[model samples]
Target: MTGPLLQTHALRAHYGDFQALFGVDIALSQGETVAIIGANGAGKTTLLRSIAGVLRNEPGAVRFDGADIGALAADAVVKLGLTMVPEGRRLFPSLSVEENLLIGAQGRKAPGYWTLKTVYALFPILAEKRRVPGTSLSGGQQQMVAIGRALMSNPRVLLCDELSLGLAPVVIRDIYAALPQIRDSGASVIVVEQDIGQAMKVADRVYCLMEGRVTLSGPPADLSRDAIHDAYFGTAA
Candidate 1:
């Protein structure tokens, strides 16, 4: 790869003594979408956290846009154009819809595409509920806000942790529908998902992790069903 927008070279993360990621290496090109799929405790969230600078790694381990950001704090990483939409739709209950979205732009430096008006355009329902508290919206709506908030940063790389976590299938479909537009904004995306079908739908490539390590990875169409099953569950069908 010629200077990937984001690259993790033998990245590892730990919470005190409990290690989460084990020499996980991944890369994302500009405007590409990669999905990371695995069962619970596969370290998907840890990878995202590491990349977004929520968790520290060894120096020179995580390079974003050719800069070493492994030691940067989460806020500093966001300023460098990397952001994550956490697994749960963690929106502020006291903040209104628009307020929550604006908060995402707080540390923004590089200008790409997303903005308050563009976010509203992406999710019209948000415009209608601009005055409502973020938590007052329906589950599906809250998820939309989370995605929109991440976009508000105008990131070069967007890390989405479980975009379809608890929503209905129809809502999931609606959320996935916006992915193409997101990619069109010139931002690479990393989606961590348990729903294989949904992940394959939006991803150009997929990586399967097991017990804190990557066990399988390839283009979605090239990965066999059996391989995916094994990687997801750590067993053959």
Candidate 2:
């Protein structure tokens, strides 16, 4: 196996004294897609936030590309080639479709496989709506813009939080259809999702979380439906 591109060791996080993450340790290697699956309030988002530097952890708690980034600020993390497609497809409503994508490349430096033209190629619908306001597009289109915006950053590791929420199955498929291309662009990914089947489809490995702790983790084919159900709901059927 390749060396880890990102890692956490005894990582803990909190929202003003209420602990949300309980010493979670996970790793992602270069060019691998790992999924963090769980129900609501399982601290999956917290884990992502911690890694992205939105929620602070002790120095050396989180490491990326052989260096410690736990104490770095969010923008600093982005500058170091780590970016997140946050939940809810948070785009700048006032910005045009093209403008939203450009913002993602603001702090980027390294020459990468993702650029405005390349991103447009990945989501051709966005190319057609290039001049439209980001919010003016439909929900599925907005989600496409969100993912594309993240791609513009040319990150070494992409952290996605709930990419399938609040979308039709067809729209979800449309969004996931881009994952293969995303992997080809030379960025590993960590997807935090509630959609088990969808996660299984795209992830090389899966980590099941419940109440801020890792319950089950392995290759998707190695995990049985019964085991996943138990890990997700905390009960066996």
Candidate 3:
């Protein structure tokens, strides 16, 4: 309660024999938005997965709201008020948009600001297509459903991985525009993004990852363009 709402301390991750992270540390405070930006294979997704409990790590590696959650399963993590909107917008092809959103509540319906109505209000298009199959919607629409689904659980911390991936610029703006409302709903957010400018705009603090380590981190205004460029690519441009 006194420190960060979510934190990863010396967090490392592996896929079979390949190591993806090396003692990575990041923190997010209540009602704040932190962005993780990096190029491909920089372990941005790996770091989100590690914190979301999709990839297990040593105990004490990830602490959330004063409890150690590194070893918890993905479902267990959701139950504890932490949820993730994954990169690909993994929605059920057979389920309707509303049904997909309902699935989030099935896991752990923590009483709070997010509900189907609130989610629909945030992304008005979702209300119109509530009866359609989730995958039948456009890429941007599907992403909305994915985010709505996560919010349905009313999480205290939301981990978003690649929210702008594969979408047009306008669609990307629409999606990013909703983040402030999400944060206003009383949830701290950690966004993993490749769009440096977008990340800089939304985040209270930005962390640049390169080669699986944090190369630079600070408030966006406090970080120079040259510093970010060097940190993102591991060399000065």
Candidate 4:
């Protein structure tokens, strides 16, 4: 793939008459992990929603595999190998862990890699509680289920929203530890995060958003803390 696997060109989003994103542009290349960081309500989640096809926009705005998919619906986007682990772990309380995983693959357009066995291997705890209701697991364990559910689709690009929302430091660590394995499994990732340190650690490239636009974007190693601080808050660190 000479070009990016996914690209957003001047993407904008609105809710009723209130706009949340302002001509945002971003990209994800094959097998790379890119992190989007910002404060609360910085349009980070909105960006993910737009790319994942939860929020519709112009067809030219979102290009996946060099094709316009911005006009597609959420389910349609997933069929094209783009899946999102939404901000909240909206697991079905009635479904067992394994059942939840199976639901994700129910609408599979084409299979590439992931399966029940592989998902269990990534989060061993899930295997032990495969028969348990999804809601009965620990926070980290539940998070694993959410991720595993998305992976079951065998997406070409995975979008993770607010991965470490409200968990203990150790739990957050455990969940993030699975990122490399996810990427290595042949799926590129775009993660929206609040923990700057954790995001910087896992991502090859980072984008700092403010209000509704990207303020700064570059490799994590190439950006200074102060620079990121400025982009994140629109002022001095």
Cα lDDT listed for each candidate: 0.91, 0.92, 0.95, 0.92
Best model per TM-score: 3
Model 1: per-residue Cα lDDT over 91-129, one tens digit each:
999999999998888868557678888999999999999
lDDT of 3 by residue, 1-237 (tens): 599989999999999999999999999998999999999999999999999899999989999989999999999999999999998999999999999999999878689999999999999999999999999999999999999999999999999999999999999999999998998899999999999999999999999999999999999999999999999988844
lDDT assessment of candidate 3: 0.95
In model 1, residue pairs whose N, Cα or C atoms come closer than 3 Å (at least 3 residues apart or on different chains), thus clashing, are: none
What range of 10 consecutive residues in model 2 has the weakest lDDT sum? 1-10
User: Which candidate ranks first by lDDT, i.e. highest?
Assistant: 3
Off by over 4 Å in 4: none
Superposed model 1: Cα runs more than 4 Å off: none
Question: How high is each candidate's TM-score?
Answer: 0.97, 0.97, 0.98, 0.97
lDDT of 4 at 165: 84
| TM-score of model number 3 | 0.98
Query: Model 4 clash pairs?
Result: none
State each model's C-alpha RMSD to the native. Answer: 1.4, 1.5, 1.0, 1.2
